[model samples]
Target chain A: MSNWVLKGLQSGVVTTRYPRKEEKAQGISPGFPDIDSQGGDINGREEDVCPTAALYGDSNSLKLDKGRCIHCFRCVRNTGHPVSWTSGFEWASFTEKGTPFPKIFQKSLYIRVVDSGDCGACLNEVKLLNNPLYNMHRLGLFITPTPRQADILLIVGPVTDHMKTALRKTYDAMPEPKRVMAVGSCALTGGIFSSGFTSGSGVSSLIPVDIEIPGCPPPPLAVLHGLLTLAGRTK
Target chain B: MKLQETVNQMQSRWNTELKIDLDLSAGTAVVHCERNTVPPLCGWLFNTMEYHFTGLVPEEGTEEWKLIYFFTGEADLGSIQVQTSAPLNEETFQSVSPIVHAVDWHEREAEDLFGLVFEGHPRLGDFVLHDDAWQEGLAPMRSGFDSDLAHSQRKPKSNWKPRKVLDAPGAFVMPIGPVFSGEAESSHFLLETIGEEIVRALPRLFFKYRGVEKLAEGKSIHDALLLSERFAGTTAFSHALTFCTAAEKLSGGQIPERAELLRIFFAEMERFRHHIGIIEGICSSTGLVVAASQAGILEEKMLRLTGKLTGHRYFFGLAVPGGLSRDTDDEAIKEALKEIKGILHDLNTLEKLLKKTSSFLDRLEDVGIITPQQAQDFELAGPMARGSHFCNDVRKLLPYGMYPSLQFEVPCEREGDGYARLRIFFEEARQAAAFMNQAAAMIKPGPVYTPYSGGEGTALAGVETPGGASWQWLRVDKNNRITRYRIMPPSFANWHGFHLAVEKFAFQDFPIIKATLGLSVAENDR
Candidate 1:
C-alpha cells in the first residue's frame, strides 16, 4: 500500500485543463467531414457513398447532418471528390427543448446513465469520463446509482424494444428540474441501426432530449463538453 | 487426429451415402447429410472425435430450413461443417445439447429468433425475447418478417415469475440488473440462495439485443462489415477482421503482406487495451479505488495511442473487405512500438505492487473456482478456459494472418480462480505487446488495399478476440449482398458456463467473479 502511494505520487497529475482552457490533445477525436468551399462542384456522387445517408442532396445544394454521421470517412476518404475533414472534439449541441440549468444547481449535478440498446462504444466513452485524466467529479458532475437522486439523464444507444420500458421508468423516477442528454450518433439519429423492428430511431422518439452529442461514439472530451454545457459552464 | 483418419472413420462407421466435399487447400470438409442424422453425427464428433462444437447456424430456404453444424479441433483436423435440411412443416429438430452442452444456448437462440423447436431440450422460450415485451410467434429472423414495421409494445406480465430451483426454508431469489447504475451494459441475474452462499445462478442477458444478424441479411459487404464491428465495440478490430477474412475467402483474394502484418499489429493493440480494462474492472470490484484509477489511466493512454495509429479509437472504419481501408506510415508504427513498451514497463511496476497487497489477494485468490472438467464440458474460450488449464487458443489451433509466423505463449493456470485469471490477463497483455513489436518489425512497403468484386460462395473465418475465439460465417450472393451472417462470439460460449463459478460462492463474491470473467453483454446479445 505504501508503494502504491509512492507510485501515485510519482505519476503526478495528468488531468486536462478543459472549460478554463481548450484541450489540445492530438488524436483525441475522429473528426467529421466538412464541405470545403474551395472544392469543385459537388458531383452528388459523394451523397450516395454515405452508408447512413448523412450526406444528401445534389450539386445545387449539399447537406451534411452531423447527428446522422458515424464518421465512417467514406465521403472524405473513399469518394473521388473528397470533402475536407475537421479535427476538433466539441460536437455537443443544444436541442430545441434544451436550456442551461439554474445557477443554484450548477455546482453539483448527479447523472444517471441508461443503455437503451447501444453497441457498447458510446457507453464506453461515457465511462472514460471517470478516469484520472478526465476526472469528471472535479467538475461537479457525478454518476448517481439511482434515478431518484439524479439531476440529469445520460442515455446511449438506439432505443431497443426490450430497454424501452426501463428507459421510460428511469425518466419518470427522476425529480423535477431534470434534463436528458443523448450521446453518440445512435442516440441522436440511430446512426446505422435506425428505427427498425426492434428499436426506435433515437432517444428523442421516446423522451424529450435536451442535449445532443453526435459521433459514432463521441470521445471522452466531447462528452465532457456535453456535461459542462448542461451545467452552463461552456461558452 | 488426422483429417483423413476422421473422414475415413465417419465413412465406415456412419453412412457411406453421405456426400462429402473436401477442400484440402483450405483444410475444410463439407458433409451433406439428412436432417435425421445430425444429432448422431454431432454426438459422434464431439464425444468420439473430440472436436469442439463451435456453433449451429440456421439458414432460411425457399421451401425448407437448412442447419449447419460447425466443429473444429486441432490444426490437423481443421474444421468440419455438416449441412442438412428440414422441411418447413417440421418445426422440431433433435437437440444436441444433451450430449454436447456447449450447443445449449445456440439451440435456444435459434428457437427464439427463428421460431424453431428443439426436441428434448428442457428450456427454450424467454431467451432472447423477453416474455414481458415481445409477443409469441414474432419470429423476427424469418426472411418474410418486415424490419420496418412498427410493433406495439406490451405491458409487463403480472403473473410472470423467475425460475426457482431451491425450495428450502429461508431460501429466496435475488434479481440483479437489466439496468445498472454506471455505464455497464444491461444484463439480469437471479441468485437463488438459502443463506449467504448461492445454490443456483441464473443469468438473463440479451436485453439489448439489436438483431444485428437479421439486419445484415440484405446489406452489402461494406455495410455488413460496419455491423460486425459495431455489434461489440471493445473488440471491434477482431470482429471486423473475422468478417473481412470470411468475405475474402469467398472472393478468393490475396491479402498483401503489409496489410496482414498491420492487421496483427492492430489486433494485438486492441487485445492489450481490452485486458487493461478488465484489470480496472477487477480492481473496482475489489474496492481498490487507487489501483482501479491507475488501470483506467493506462487504458485511456492505450486508447489514445490506438487513435493516433488508426484514426478511430476502437478501429472502426479501418478494416475493409479485401484489406485495410487506410495505411499507417512507418514512422507512426515506430512511435507506437515505443509507447507500448513504456506502457508495459509501468504495467510491470503495478503488477509488482498488486502482488504485495494482501487485501487484494485475499479477495481474488481461491475465489470463483471453475474446474478443468467443467471448462471442457462447457467448451469455454479465452482466458476463462485458459485459467482452468484448457489451452485451446484460436491463434494456435487455427492460425491465420501473421500468427503462424509470430511468437507468443498462450498462458495457462491450474488454480482456475479469480487470481489465476488475473495473472493470465497480465501475462497475455505482455505477449500481445511482444507480438505487436514483432509485427511492426516485419512490416514492409506495399499496397494495403486490394479490391475484390463480389462472388457467390459460403465461407467461415475465426479470429482470436480479447474474449476468446470469435467465428463469423457468411454466405454472399452473386450480387455481393449477404444472404446469411452468423456470429459465434466468445462471450456466448463462455456465458453458458458462468454458473459453474458462481453457484457455490457467497453473494458478496458475485461482482468480483463477474468482473474477473469480463464477458461482454453486447457481444453475447448481438
Candidate 2:
C-alpha cells in the first residue's frame, strides 16, 4: 500500500488529445468494410467463406448489407485484397424523419447501445467510444446512455426471445427520427443463431435495420464506421 | 507433481469414462460427463486430491441443459471442464456450495435462471429472483418463458423479506437499496445488525434481470462471444477470451504462439488498468482526493491505452475465434509498451507519496477487517480474496494464455479488509507491470490473429477477470452453428465473499464494503 502511493505521484497525466488532431489515430474498434461489389473474385471468396449468410449473392454483382455482415474477416483473410482497417473514429448522425445509418461524418452522431440479445463482445465495441483514445465526444459521437436522446440505436447480438421485447421497448423509448444499426453478426440475420433462435431475429424483422456491421464482434473502429453511416458522416 | 498424480488417480478411480478432447483448431479442451455426477467428481478433485472448483457455467439448450464445471490444478497450465449431461427436466443438481463455499451464489443463480433446484443448498433461499415471485416448481430458465407469458406474468420483484430480527435482542434489520448513488446499477442489500457491528449482510441481487444467459441461447459460439463480452462491460475481454478459449478448445483450433502472446499483453493491460481504477474508486469513496486523483489519472491513462491498441479502449473485437482481431506492428507495440512503462513509473511514485499522507492512512488503516478464518470460509478471489490470506490465484492455479510462461507474484495480506484489499491491488499493479514488460520483450513478431472456421464441437475456455475467473462454455452442433453458450463469471462467486464482509461491517461502510467486494451487477445479471 505504501509503495503504491509513491508510484501514483510520479505518473503524469495520461489522457489523450483527441479532437485536437494531435495524432492520426482512428480510434478503437473502427471498421467500414469497403466491399467493391464490382470486384468479382474478392466477392467470390467473401461469399464462399462467409460463416454467416450475410453476403448477398447476385448475378455478376456483389451486394453487401453491412446490417447483416459480421466482419469475420474470413472473407478477407482467405483472399488478397487490402483488409487493413481504417481507424477513423468520428461516426454519428441525426435525423428528425427516418432513422440514421452508421457512416463517417464530421458533425458526429449520438448512438445508444442497446443489448437486445447480444453476447457482450458487441457491447464492448459500443463502450470503446467512451474511451479517451477514440474519444467519440471528440468526433461529436456521443453515447447517450438512454434511448430518448439517441438517434441511432446500436443493436448488438441477435434478438433472443427474452430480449425481443426489450429491444422493441428500447427503440420505442428512443426519440423518433431514430435509425437502427445492427453492429454484430448476431444482430444481422441472426447471423449464427438464425434458425435456432428461440424468439425473434435481427432488428429488420421487428423495427427496421438500416445498416448492419457484421463480425463475431465487430472491431470498435468498424462500429464507429457503422455509426458514421447512420449519421451520414462517412466519406 | 503430487497433486497431478492425485487428480489422475481420482480420474481413474472414479472410473468415469473420460473422452479427452482438445479443440486444436481453437486451442481449447472438453471433458464431458453426466450432470448429477459433477458434485462427487468435484469433491474428489477439491478434497480427495487438490483440484479446486473454479466455476460452474450453464448454457441454454433446447432438448437438454448443459453445465460445465472448470477445475484448476497445482502446476501446469492445464484446466479440466466437467461436462454433465442432463435431460432438460428442470431438476437442480445437488449444491457444491457445501464443498466449495464459492458456489453458494452460483447455485442460487442457477435456481433463479435455470429454474433448477439445488435440493440440499444450506441456504437455498432466493439470492436473485425472489422466492415468493417464482415458486420452486416454476422454472424461469425454461425455453417456454414466452414473452407474452413473461410480460403478462411479468411479476413484480419479490418483496420477500429475510427473517426479521427487529423483534430480537441486540438485533435489528434494515434493507439498503435496489437503487444506489454513484454510478451503481440497482441492487438491494439487507443488513441485520447488532449494536454497531453487522450480523448478516444479505445481498438481494437481480434487480435488473437482463436475461443475458437466456439470450445467448442457440447462437453460434463465435457470435455468442459478443454476448459473452456483454455479461460484464468493464471486463469484457475476460469473458470473450474465456468463451473463445472454450470454443477454440472444443473445435481443436490451433492458436498461434504469437497470437497467444498478444492476448496476454492485452489481458495484463486490462488487469492493471481495472485494478488501478477499482482502487482509485475505493480512495474516492473515502474522500482521499489526492489518492483518488492519482488513481484516476492512471485509470484514464489505461483506458487511453486500451483505445490505442485495439482501437476501442476496452479492447473489443480484439478477441475473435482463433486469435486477436489484428496484430500490432513492431514499432506500434513498442510505443504502446513505452507509454505504459512511463505511467507505471509515475504510479509507483504516486503510491509512495500518498502513503506518506497521514489523512489517507488514518481512513484506510483497520477500516474494514476480515480475519483469515472469515476469508477462507468465504473463499474470496482477486485482491479481496488475496487480502484474506488464501493463496488462491486462478492465474497460477489455473494458468491461461501465456501466463504459464510469464513469471509474476501474487500479493496477499492477512487483514482481508478494505485497506488490505487496496494494498493488494497496489502490489498487483506493480507485479502486472513486471509481467507485461516481460511479455512485450518476449513477444515474437508474427501474425497476431489466425482465422478459424467452426465444426461440430464444444469447449470450456476461461480467462481471469479483475473479479476472478470468467468461464464460457460453447457448443457447436453438426452445422457449425452455436448450439449452446453458457457463462459463469467471478462476480457470481464473489457474492458469497461479499456477504461475509458486509454482514460483519457497519451499515455505513456499505459504500466501502461494496467497493472492496467489487461485484459487477452487469456481469452477474448477464
Candidate 3:
C-alpha cells in the first residue's frame, strides 16, 4: 500500500482543469475550422477545397459544420482560406439530443444523427458521459445505444446495409418525441464514398431528422453541446 | 515490405481489380475486395500469408449494404485495391471462422447487421440483433432498407419471438450487457459456464451498431473522414488514418514532413497510454498493487502529455483528413518531454523492482502459456502476440511515421504467458520513452498538418496501434462520397487466442485472461 501511494504521488496530479480554463490543446476543438479572415473568394475556395461539403456557404462567409467534419482541413489547412481551429475538449450538454452548435436557418437545419453506419468512435464519443473527464452525466445526457433513447436520433455514417435493421429497430424503439439528428456529414448528406453499392441515401431519406451536427467525429464537447441543444439545455 | 510482394502475388491469383492500397506513413496493407470473395480472401490471408483476422465492419444502409474485411501482418499499401463484392440479396459465403478462429465474433456480427449468411458457420443466427423481426431473406445491411420501419409500409411484428434456449444438459445460459456498467461501448456476453468454467460463450453485440459504414454513402470525400474516425473508441485516429491515407492517395494530397512528425507523436502517445492501461488492468486482475500503481501513473502521465501536445487526452480530433489537427508547440512539447523523461526513469526502476516480487510473478508466469506454434496458429499480434513468442508489430514490419527515422528494438519472449506480457510492457515502455526522446530531440519543427485534396480514386492507410495492426480501406466516389470504408482493429483478431487460453483455465482467472487478450468489444461490434 505504501509503495502504491508513493508511486502515485511521484507521478503527480494528472487532471485537466478544462471548461474553467482555456486549453491550448484544443486551439479550435470539435473540428472547428480556423477562421482566418479569408479573401473575397474564400467561400468558393472553401467549397471547392472541401471534400465532404461540411463547409456551408453563405452569401458572404463559409460556415463550417463541425459535426460533419472529419478534421481533414481541406478548406482550412490545404486551401489558403486560413480558417483553422485547435482541439477543444470541453463539450457537454443538457441531453443526448442537444446541439452545441448555433442554429442557422439557411445553414442546413433540422437533422438527426443516425449510426446509419459507422465504426464505434462516434458512439464511443457519445458514451464518454460516464467518464469523470467529460462528466456528461451531470447534464442528464446519456446515450441509449438504441434510437429509442434518442429524440433526434443522430446518424454518423452513410448507413451500411447490415446496420439498416439495427437502425430501423432503434428508430422503432424510440417514442413519438423522437427527431432524427444527422450528427456527421455522413448522416446528414453522406460525405465521401457515397456512391458505393453499400451506400445509402442521407439520413433524411430514412428518417425525419429535426437537426444536424456536421463533423467527422465532432469533439466531445461539441457532441455534448449538440445533445444539449436537442434537449434545449443550451442557455 | 514483404506484404507488398504477397499482395502482388495475390493479385495474379485475383484479377478482379481487388488491389490493396498502401499508406507507408501509417504502416498498413489494405485489400478492398468484393463482398463475394471476402471469405476466401480472409482464408487466404490467415492460412497462406502471415496475416491474422482483425475484424469485419458491417455497414448497414437503407438502400445498400457493405461488409468490410480488415487484416494485418502482410498486406499491400501505396497501390490499387483488389475488391470483389456482391449484392445484399445474395448474402451467402463460405465461413472464414473455420480458418481464422478469431473471426467468429466478426462473422456473427456481420450476420447480425447485414444479414450475411455464412455457410457452415455453427452459431450464426442472431448473435447481436436479438429482435424477432429479423427475417431470413430480408437482410438489414442493404442500403435500401427504410430507416424507420414504423413509418415504412411493412407490417408490425406479430406472432414471432426469439428462439427459446433448448432444454439440453447444462444448457442454461446467463447474459451480461449491452447495458453493463463498464468501459468501452455497450455489448452483452452470453456464457454457459459449468462450475466456473465457460463451456460456451456467445457475444451479443450491436446494441450500438448504427450503420456507421452506411452513413458514409453518398457523402463528399471530406465528410467520410469523420465517418472513418468513429469506427472504434480507443483507436479512432488509427482508423481514420487509414481512411485519410486512402483518400490522400486517391485524391493525390501531399503530406508535409512536419505533418508526418506530428502524426507519429499522436500515434505513439495513443500506444503509450493504451499499453499502460492494459498493463494496469492485468496487475489489478492479479492484485499487484505496485505494478498497477506504477501503470496507473504511467497512464495518467501519458494522457496528460497527450493533452499538452494535442489538447485531447485520448488524442481525439488530432488526425485530420490529410495531416494533424493542431500543430503541437515545440517548447511546450519540449517541456512535456522533460517531464515524461523523469516519469520514464522512475518507471524503469519500478518495473525492475516488480520482476523481483513473487506475488506478481506467481500470477503471471506460465498462467496461460501458449506455445509459439499455438500462438502462430492462433495468429496473435500486438503485445499479447509478442508475449507469446511472435514478432507482430506493424511498426516493425512496416515502418510508418517517425519509426523509419528512429531506431528501436521490439521485445519478444519464448514463454507465452502473462509474465512475459508484463515484462514486455516494461521493456516497451522504456523503448517508448527512448523513442519519444529521440523524436522530440531530433524532430525539426515545421507546418504540422495538411488537408486532403480528392482527385482520382480511393487509397488505403494502415497503422500499428497498441492492439496490433489496425487497418482502414476507403474509397471516395467522383462526387466525394464514401463508396466503401472498412476497418479492422487488433482486438478483432485476438478473440480466438484469448478463448483458446481460457479453454482449460478455471473461470476464476477469466478477468486477468480477458484483460490480457485486451480485445475491445466495441471495436469488433462494428
Candidate 4:
C-alpha cells in the first residue's frame, strides 16, 4: 500500500491543462457537421439522409442544427455534397434565457447530476471528469449529492416519463442561485430518442436549460467546457 | 442432443402430433403447438432435456398473439423455438415461471408491456412501468397504443408500498435510489432488514425506460440500429453487431473476412475497457482511492484510443447490416495494439498489489456469495455467472464473428464471492487484450461494407458482449422496415439474480457487491 503512494508521486501530473492551456489531443472529439463552403443545393436526397433531421432545408438553403446532430456522419459520409466536419471540443453554448452563474459562486460550485433517462454514454463521460486526467477538483468544481447544497444541476438524457417528477422535484429543491447544464445530444434535442412515447423531447421542456453541450454523448472535454461555461471560466 | 432428436422425443413423450419446420442452415427448429401444451413443453425442455430457456418473444398479430419461446443447449443442438398463439379475445395464458424460475421476469415484462395475463405469474404490473407514474391498463407495447403521443400523467398511488416479507418488531425497509450520487443510473432498491443483515432485497428498476422496443416498431433498419446502440451505450458495438447479424441473416448476406476480424477486434476492445471500468468501480466501492484513480486513467486511455481508431468513443454507427460501416486502417490498429500491451503491463502490476492488500481482500472474500446452483436457476450471464463456475460464454457455446477460429480461455472461479468476480474480471480483461492482438494480426485487406438488399423475414442473432450474451431478434417487412425488434440484454438476465447476492449480505456490503456484479441499469431498463 505504501508503494501506491510512491507510484502516484512518480507518475506526476497527467491532468489536462484545459482552460489554462489548450488540450490538443488528436481525435479527442467526434466533431459536428458544418455547412461546407462549396455547398450545393439541398436536394431531396440530402435533406432525407439524416436520421434525426439535424440537417434539413429547401434546395436554396440548408441548416445544421448542432443540438439535434448525433454525429452519425451520414451527411458527411454518405451524401453527394458533404457537409464539412469541424473537430474541436469547445461546443458549449448558452441557451436563450440562460446566463452564467454570479461572480460569488464562480470559483467554487457544487453540481447535482440527474440521470433522467440517459442511455449511459453521457453519464459515463460525466463520470470521467472526476478521473485523474480531467480532474474537475483543481478547477473548484465538485459533485454534491443533494440539490440543497448544489449551485449547478448537470443533467443527461432525454427526460423519460417515469423520471419527470423526480427531475422537477430536484430542480425545485435547489437554491435561488442555481444554473442547469444539459449534456449530450439527447438532453439537448432528444437526439434519436426524440418524440418517443415515454420520453420528453429534451430536458428543457421540463426545466429551463442554461448550457447545452451537444454530441451523441459529448466527450469529457466538451462536458468540462459546459461546466466551465456554467462557472463563467471558459475562454 | 440434436434438434431432430429432441423433437422426436417430445412428440413420443407427449403423445401429441406437433407441426414442425426446420431450417438446417440457420440451425433452428420451429415447433408449433397448442396454447394448452405450452407449459408442459417448456417444462419438458427445461427439466428433462436440460435446455437453457433463452427468452420468450411476444408478437402481436392481426387475429392472435404469438409467443415464441427460445431454448438452447450445446452448440451442436442449435436453437429450438416453440411457437404458440392465443385468440385476440382471450388475453390469459399459462405461466411457465413455476416450472422454470428463469422465466419469471420475462412473463412479468410481457404482462406489463402487452397487457397479456400470465395466469400464474406471482406478480405482473408495476414491473417496468411504476403504478405511481402510469395507469394500470395502459399497455405501452400494444399495437393500439400510440408511440408518439405522450399519455396523461396519472395521480400517484398514495397507498402503494414496496413488497416486504420480513415480519418482526425491529424489521424495517430502507429505500435506496431512483437518483443516486455520482454517475449511477436511475434504479431503486428496497432493502428489508431487522439488523445489519438484509433479510430481503427488492430491486425496482426501469426508472429510465424509454420504450426502446415500442419506438422501433415502424423504423427502418438504419434507424432501428441507432436505437439499439443508444439504448445501452456501454456495449454499443456489441448490440449493433447483434442487430446487424440478424439483419444480415434475414437478407442472406455474408460479411467479408476482414470485417469479421475487425468486429472481433472492436468487440474485445470494448470488453477490455468495460472490465477496466468495473475494476475502477470495485476499487472505489472498497475505498481504494489511488488504485481506483489509476484504473480510471487506464479506462480513459482506452476510451481515447477507441475514439482515435473509430470516430466514436463507443463504436456507434460503425456497424451496419452486411458489414462494418467503415474500414479501420491497419497501421493504426497495429499502433493501438502496442499501446494496449503497455496498459496490460500496468494492469498486471496493479492486480498483484490488489491481491496482496489484506484490507481489500477482507471486504470481498465472502461478502456476497451466489452459488453455481443459484446462478443456473436465475440464468445469470456474463462474468457474474462465470465467477460462480457456470462456464457459460456465448463466444464459446454459440460462437459468432471470428471466435470459432480464434483461441481464448473462458476463465471461471469456484468461489462465487465478490473476490472471485473481481478476479474473473481481471482475467477476462487479459484474455480480451489477447484477442485484440490476435485479431489485429489476422486482419487482411478486403471490402468492409456490403450493400445488402433487405428482404422480409425474421431472424435471431446473439453476440458475446462485455456483460454477456445479448440476443437480438428482428422481424422485417418486405420494404426493409422493422415490424418487431426484441433485445434480450445480458444485464436483464443478470438483474434477475442480483437479489440472490444482495439478500443475505450486510448493508455495508451492498455497494461492493453491486460493483462486483457490474450490471448496467440502462441496459436492463431498455
Candidate 5:
C-alpha cells in the first residue's frame, strides 16, 4: 500500500479542470468540416466520392449534418469546393426536452451508458471520460451500472434488432424525468450502417433522444461535454 | 522440403488417382475429389498429422457450394487449402467437427449462414443469426436470399427456451445478461453454479451480430475496407490490413516498402494501446482503481497519438487497398516515438506496483488455468495461447509486411494461468514498444498508394492482431468488386477457451478471467 501511495504521489494531479477552465483539445479531435470561402455547392464531386453518402448538394448551397459526417475527409480532399476542418470538441447538449431535468439531479447526475450495437469505438471514448485527464466524477457525473439509479441514459451504436429489447428495457428501468443522449454518428443517423436489415437507422426509433453528439465516434472530451451539458454545468 | 515430402506421401496414400494442382508460391494444394472423400482427408490432416485447423469458408452461388478448409502446416510451408463441392439445393457435407474440435464452431457458423448440413455434427444451431431473423429454409448469406426480403418477411420468435437444470441437490443456474453492467459489448453468460463455485459456463453469444460479411458483399473492395475496419474498433488496423492484403493480392499490386513499414508501425501502435487497455481492465477487476486510471492515461495519450498520425481516432480510412491512404510526417512519427518511450516507462512503473500488491496478485494467480494440451486442443491464439507455451504468434511463424525483417520476441509462459496471461501482456507491451522504435527508425519516404492492375481471383491474408491471428479470404470479380469475403478473427478461435478457463472457479473470479482474456464480442459476432 505504501508503494501504491508513493506511485500515486509520483503521478501528481493529472486531472483536468474542465467546465471550470477551457480544456484546449487541439489536434486530438477528428474535427468537423467547415464550408470554406469557395464553398457554395458540393459540385457533385464530393457527393459521388463520399463512402457514407453523408454529403448531398445541388447547384445552390451545401449543408453538413454532423450526425452523418464520419470525418473520412474524402470530401475535403476530392471536392471542387474548398472545405476546411473546424477543431471544436464541445458539441454536446440536451438537444430536446421531453421533460425538464428532475429537481433532485440539479447538483449530481448518474448516467448509464448502453451499447445498442456499437462497433466499440464510441464505447471506448465514453470509457475514456473517467480517466484522470477527463475525470468525470470531479464534474459530478457518475456512471451507474443499474438504470434504476440513472438520471441520464447515454446510448451508443446503430441500435440493432437484437439490442432493441435490451435498450427498451434499460430505458424503461430508468427513473422518470430522465434524459437520453445518443453519442457518435452511428447513434444519431446510423453513420455507415444505416437502416440495414440487422440495425435500426438511429436510436430515436426505439427511445426518445434528447441530446445527440456526433462524430464517427465522438472524441472523449465531446462525451464529457455532453454529460456536463445534460447536467446543466456547461455554458 | 519437408512440406514437399509430406505432399508426396499424401498423394501416394490417396492412391495417386486424384488430380492435385499445386501452387507453390501460394503454398496451396488443390485436390478435386468427390464430396465423400472430405472426412477421411480431414481425419488424416487433423488426427494423424496434428495440423491446426484454422477456419472453414463456405461459398454459395447458383448451382454449387464451394467449401474450403484452411489449415496451418508444419514450419513455414504455407497454409494448406482443402477444397470440395456440394450441390447448393441439397447441400450436405460430412462434418469434420467429429475429428477436429476446433472447427466445431466454424462448421456451425457455416450451417447458420449458408444452410449447409453438417452431417453427424453436434450442436449446429443458431450462432450468428436469431431464429426469427429469416425463414425456415432460407439462409441470409447465400447469394439467392435477399437480406431485405428476409427482413420484410421476418417472424418474431421468442428465443427463450427451457434449460436443463443440473441434477445436483444444491446446483442451480444463474443467467447474466445479453446486456451487462459497465461498457461491455452485449453477451449472455449462463453460469451453472453450486454456492459460489461455477460448475459449468455456457456462453450464448451473437447479441452483437450485424452481418458484416453480408454487408461487404457486392460492395467495392475499397468501400468494403471501411466495413472491415469497423469489424472491431480496438484492432482496426490489423483487420483492415488483412482485408487490404487480400484485396491487394486479388488486384495484383505491390505495396511500397514505406507503406509496409507504416502499416507495421500502426499495427504495433494498436498493440501498445490494446495491451495497456487490457492492463487497465486487469487492474480495475482486481480493485486497483488507481492503477487502472493511470493505465487509462497512457491509453488516452496513445489514442491522441493515433489521432495525430491518422486523421480519425480509431485510425479508420487511413489503411486502404494497395497501401495506406495517407502518409505520416517524419516529425510527427518522431514525436510519437518519444512519447511512447515515456509511456513505456510509466507502464513499467505501474506493472511493478501491481506485482508488489498482494490483493491484485492473489485474485489473478492460478485463478484460470488452461493446460498446454487444452490450449492446443482448443486452438487458442494470442497471449492466451502463448501463456500456455503455444507459439501461436502469426508474425513470427507466418511473417507479413515488415515483420519478416523486424526484430522482436514472442513471449510465452508455461503457467497458463491468469497471472501467466498478465505477464505475457507486459512482455508483449515492452516488445511492441521496441518494434515501434525500430519501425520509426527504418521508415523511409516513398509513395503510399499503388494502383491495382490485375483481374479477379481469390487470395488469403492473415495478420497477427493484438489478440491473435485475424485472417481474411476475399474473392473478386473481373470488375474488382468483392464477390465473397470471409474473416476469422482471433476472438472467434479463443472464445471457447473461456469455457475451459472458467470451469471449477468461484463466481467472483469471472471478472478477472474475462478481463485477462479481453475478448471482443463485435469481432467474434461479425
Candidate 6:
C-alpha cells in the first residue's frame, strides 16, 4: 500500500486547472461546427446529409441546432468548405425565460445522473467529469446517490420506454427547484435513435429541461461547461 | 474433429436430407436441414462435436421466416450456420435450449422480436421489450409491421407488473436497481440470499433497449452503422468494424491493405483503453483508490489520443461500410505509437504495484469463480472465457486483417476468479500495445475509403470486441439497403456465464465480481 502511494506520487499531479485556466487538451475535443462565412453560398446539401437533422439551410443561410448535433462531421466531410470544426467548448443554455440561477446551488451542487437510455458514450464522458483531470468536485459539483438529495438532474441518453417510469420517479423524488441538464444529443433531440418503438424522442418530452449539452457524447470539459452554465457561472 | 468430418458423420447418422456447403475459405458453412432436424443437429454439434452455440438469427421474408442457428467450434476457426424456415402463418420451430443451454436467451429474443414460437423453451417471457410496453401477440421486427405506427400509439404510462418475489424459511428475495446510485447502468437484479450468501440472482435487463436492431432495418448500411457504433460506447470500434465487415461482404467491396492495417490499429487502441477502464473499475470496487486513479489517468490519456486521431473521442464516424471514413496521417500514427510506448511503461509500473498489493488481490483471489465447464456450457467470450482456460481469443483462432501477420500471445488463466480476470486484462493491455506498434510499422499509404457497390447478397462477419467476438448477419437488397441486420454482441453471449458466476458467491463480493466481468448492459439488452 505504501508502494502504491509512492507510485501515485511519482505520477505527479494529474489534475487540471480548468475554469481558472484553459486546458491544453481542450483543442482536441470536437466542438460545435462553425459555418464558413466567407467561402461560398449555402447550398443546403448539408441539411440533407446530416444524420441527426441538426443542420438546416436555405439557398443563402444555414442554421445549426447544437442540441441535435451528434458531431459525426458528415457535413464538414461532405461539403468540404461550408462547415468546419470549432474549438468553442461552451454549448449549454437556459431553456426557459427569466429563470434565474439558483444561488443556493452556487456553493455545492449535488447532481443526480439519470440514464434514460444512453448509448454509453455520454455516460462514459459523464464519469470522466469526476476524474482527476476534470476534478469537478473542486468546483463544488458532486454526484449524489439519489434524486432526493440532488440539486441538479443530469440526464443522458435517448429516453427508452422501459426507463420512462424510473426517470419520472427520479425527477419527482428530487426537491423543488431542481434543474434538469440534458447532456448529449440523445438526451437533447434523441440523436439517431430518436424514431423507434423503444425510445422516446428526447428527455424534454417527459420532463422540463433547463440546459442542453450536445454531442454524440460531449467531452468532459463541455460537460463541465454545461454544469457551470446551469449554475450561472459561465456565459 | 474437423467441421467437414462432422457434416459427414451427421449425414450418415441422421435420416433427414442435408445439404452441407463447406466453404472453409469463407470460415463458415451453410447446413440446410428440415425444421424437424434442428434438435438432433444441435445436440450432436454441441455435445459430441464440441461446438459452442453462438446465436439464433431470425429473418422475416414475404413468404417465410428463416431461422438460422450459428455455432462456433472450440478452436474458433470455423462457424456452422443451420438454416431452417417456417411459413409466415406457421411460425413455430423446435427449441435448441434443451440440447444447448446457451440458446435459451437467444430463442427467447427471437420469440419476442420476430414472433416465432420456440416449442418447449423453458420460459419465453419478455426479453428485449418491456413487460409494460409489450403488447401481447404483437411482433415488432416482422417484415410488414409498421414500427412508426406502434411507437406513436404507445401508452404514456408503464404497465410494469412486478415479478413474484421468491420466499422461503429464512430465504427472501431482494430486488434492486433499474436506477442505481453507484453509476451502475440501468438494470434490475432480484437477489434471493440466505444470510450473507446468494442463492439466486435474476437480472432484469432491457431497461436501456432502444430497439437498435429493429431501427437498423430498411436503412442504408452507412446510416445504420452510426447507430451500431453507439450500441455500446466501450466496444464502439469493434462493433462498427464487425458491422462494416458484414456490409462490405454483402456489397462486394474490397478493403485496401492499408485500411485493414488501420482497422487493426484502432481495434487495438480500443481494447487498450477498455482493459484499463475495467482494471480501474475492479480497483475502485476493491477500495484500491490509488490504483484506480492511476488506471483512470491511463484511460483518460488513451481517450484523448483517440480523440486526437479520430474526430470523435469514442471513435464514432471512424468506420464506414467499404473502409474508414477518414485516414490517419503517418505523422499522427507515429505520434500515437510513441504515446502507446509511454502507456506501456505506465502499465508496467501499475502491474508491478498491483501484484505487490496483497489487500487488493485478497479481495479478488477466490471470489466470482467460474469453472471451464461453465464457460463452455454458456459459450462465454473474450477475456472472461480466457480466464477460465477457454483459449477463445478470436484474433488467434480466426485471424482477420493485420492479425494474420501481427504477433501477440493469446493469454489464458486456469483460475477463473476475479483476480484471474484482472490478470487477463493486464496481459491483454500489453498485447494490444504491441499490436498497435506492429500496425504502425505495416501501414502503407493508400486510399482509405473504397466506393461501395451494393448488390443483393447475404453475409456474416464476426470481429473480436473488448468483451468477446461480436457476430453479425446481414442481408442487403440490390440497392444496398439492409433487409435484415442481426447482431449477437459478445456481452449477450457472456451474460449467462456472468449470472452463473455470481451465484453462490458471498453477497458482499458482488460489486467486485461484476467489475471484473466488465459486462455492458446496453450491449446485452440491445
DockQ of 4: 0.66
The candidate with the higher lDDT, 1 or 5, is: 1
> Which docking category, incorrect, acceptable, medium or high, applies to candidate 4?
medium
Candidate 5 chain B TM? 0.96
Q: What is the TM-score of each candidate against the true structure?
A: 0.97, 0.72, 0.68, 0.98, 0.96, 0.96
For all candidates, what are the clash counts? 0, 98, 142, 0, 0, 1
Worst 10 residues of 2 chain A by lDDT: A89-98
Q: Write the per-residue lDDT of candidate 6 for residues A79-143, one digit (tens) a residue.
A: 34446567656677778642535776677788998888887778888888877778798999999
Q: Estimate, for each residue in B302-353, the C-alpha lDDT of model 3 and write its tens digit.
A: 6556655664455555676667766777887788778777777766777666
For model 4, the stretches where C-alpha displacement exceeds 4 angstroms are A40-48, A58-61, B148-150, B153-156
Residue-level lDDT of model 2, residues B286-359, one tens digit each, is 77756676666657667657766676666655687788866787677788788888888867876676667676
Lowest summed lDDT across 10 adjacent residues in model 2 chain B is found at B177-186
Cα lDDT tens digits, model 2, A1-235, are: 3554444445443445533434454333335445543443334432234555445564245555554555445444443443333334333322234344423333756676666545444654455455433446656777665677777777765665444555677788887667777766667667545543243456677777667666556665567666656665545
